[model samples]
Target: MDLDVAQVRAFVRTAEELHFGRAAGTLAISQQALSKRIARLEALLGTPLLLRGGTGVRLTEAGRRFLGPARRTVAAADAAVAAVSGADRPLHVDTWGHLYAPMRTLARVAGRAGELVSGHGRDLPSVAKALLNGDVDAAFGRVHPPLPAGLAHRLIRLEPVDAVLSADHPLAAEPALRPDRLSGGVLWAPGPLDRLDFLHRFAVRFGVRHTATSVNLGLGHFLAEVAREPDRFSLMPADVPLPRVPGLRSVPLTDPTPLYAWSLLWRSGDEHPGLKGLVTACAEEGGRSRWLEYDPARDWLPEPPASGPEPV
Candidate 1:
């Protein structure tokens, strides 16, 4: 039987992710397209390769047996293309958390990293999938627990977060606000609290009682919404340039500052020529700007910093 390499690739990526939505994203296709590819592959094999249920997709016995050969097939196809097209293709990089201004960090290293094609992922999960699927060479974002296997990350920056409040708010005038001091007010988040790891953990850790979510139209709109209510406030990286929203002030959180961690993520075995230079640039920049400096006694992180040197 003649196997379609694309269909085999679709199955492999879906099996790896176990989530159709993320698998489709990594392939840069719609969910419907991904499903069709998998269905066709199963039909070609004359048996169901995967079982879909409430929990997630699961591999059938046939699928378990086919996975190894399928991976080799995909790798062979990629190698053939690379050999013919040359290896000088621009490295594709992606980022997540636009609201936090991930580009601000990437911009500093882009020029030094050589030719690059940049894109954006909805979040770290999507970006991680893209890395594993070989769609992108590198990514930058907050790397937390429960990440998929076969991925690596390095802590690049530890940006201090600030509380954005309306100028009319009582605490807005304070030179610096302690985390617990804002516990009485509502925490305005750009999206659902659960999806926003940093904000959610900050609320629970610092005793923020009331929380509200809003669509993240853009930084300006989000900040404007936060400024509309005297009792509402939200967290943002201190270095992000605040749009000129009226009656909005950013107050630094003190007595244990909340440091938003930024990390570089890529597939474990990737040897993309540009990857090393990018990591080196991040390390140099981090050292020059003290981006990785953290003191547990004076700062807060949702988890302990990643261990080991920056992956080169």
Candidate 2:
């Protein structure tokens, strides 16, 4: 029997929620209807997909194995529909809010009709999902390793990350702070979850014992937290200016300063002539723009220690 999209969608939603009632609510159907859909899916597959229990439901081995492909199948179908329906629409470009200067420059060079969608204070996973699902035509953000297999990417610029500290702190008097000085300090702005391995490697390389903590706050509040706490510090791109607080200062992290490389990513095999023009514009404008001023002394930092955190 052929697989049915509706049944597959119901199964996927049920698998995600792990609750028939909630999944049905999400799908705007009654629990009974949701159960029937999942039953039909199981019948078509000729195997038990989910195990029903008192604590709700759990995906059986077969269900676990099929989850990835099911999601991809749905995404592919959605992307095809979007491509045909939006053929005449302008390109949608996503990037960090602070990086708009360079992205705007790219748009001008491309000379194509498009809009910039800023990912302000958003993490990499969400951005990647948007690209994969065709929510956006192109995007710019920090380099995420093991980029999705079907996407193409190019390095745009290398922006150095600087240390933010309370101006009155003892180390604040130094012209440049050493990486080792960060030991036992708390990082107010936690790095992305996808970079857990990288963060571990960084800590080992610098011989620093730092704890990263996340705070959900706007720029004003974030700066206030840094200014109020003597030991609390943050790492931010030197190219982007932070809210100026009376007791806060942005200083270069020395003895080894880390650089965050920004990249432009798009779906591979996408043959939109306009996209090609956009890519050309990005390279051309990126070449002439001084989005980042690289200091030779800080151009390259020491790599993480050979023996570091294991991949997650």
Candidate 3:
């Protein structure tokens, strides 16, 4: 029986994510389409591959047995396509956490990294799924654990964070403010606190009790909102260029500054030539700019950086 590559691919992605919505997102297809593909693949094999329960999807014995070979098949198909299309295709890189302006860091290395095609992911999970699906060659973002298997990351930068508030706010005139100084004020965030791992961790750690959120329309809009409320404040990477939002003041956070970690994520065992160039360039730029310097006594990270040796 001739196996459809698309169906096999659907199964592989679904098996990796175990969530149809995310898997469908990685495939850039609708959930219905993903379901149809999985169903057809199961029918062709004449066996159930996945068990769907109230909790979530899980691999049946057949699926567990087929997963390894299915992954190989998908890789082979991708290899075949790359072979004919010329391997010099521009490396596609996805970025998330736009509030931090991750591209600013990427730009420092872009000149040395060669041809690149940039895309934006909604968040780290979506970017991770895209990396797993081979939809993008690499991604940049603030990666938090537990990172999914089959991926690798290298810490590229640790940016000091600043507390942004209205110039009219009482604390705005301070050159540097301790994190606790903002405890009584509302911590403004871009979305639901639970969904924003970094900000949520910061709030919980710093004793910021009251919290508020706004749609992440962009840096300008978000900062403008913060500028409007004297008692509202938000965190931003110190290096992000501030927009001309009136009444905006960015004060450095001192006495254990919160550092925003940035990392480069790619599929483990990827042999793309451009991937090597990008990694090397990041290392060079990071070293030159002192991007990875950290002092536990004076700096704070939500979690330790994932800068361990590359996984095999």
Identify the candidate with maximal lDDT. Answer: 3
Q: Give one digit per residue, the lDDT tens place, for model 2 in 10-128.
A: 88778777888878987789999989988999988899999999987999999999876776665566556657885555667676534223344454455543434444325455566
> What digit string (tens of lDDT, one per residue) describes model 1 on residues 1-312?
998999999999898888899889878999999999999999989999889999899999998888767766775676567656846878788999999999999899889988889998998888876776777878988888788766788888999999999998889999999999999999999899878888999999999999999998999999999999999999999999989999999999988999999998887656666778889888988899889888999999999685675555
The models' CA-based lDDT, in order, is: 0.87, 0.64, 0.90
Alpha-carbon error at 126 in model 1, in Å? 1.7
**Candidate 3 lDDT tens digits, 1-312:** 999999999999999989999889978999999999999999999999999899999999999999877876776677578767847988899999998899999999999998999999999998997887888889999999878766789888999999999988899999999999999999999999887999999999999999999999998999999999999999999999998999999999999899999999987766666888999999989889999889989999998664573632
lDDT of 2 at 229: 76
User: Could you give the candidate ranking by TM-score, starting with the highest?
Assistant: 3, 1, 2
Comparing candidate 1 with candidate 2, which one achieves the higher TM-score? 1
The residue pairs in collision within model 1 are none
Q: What ranges in model 3 sit over 4 Å off?
A: 1-7, 14-47, 52-58, 61-73, 76-84, 306-312
Clashes of each: 0, 0, 0
Error of 2 at 67 (Å): 2.3
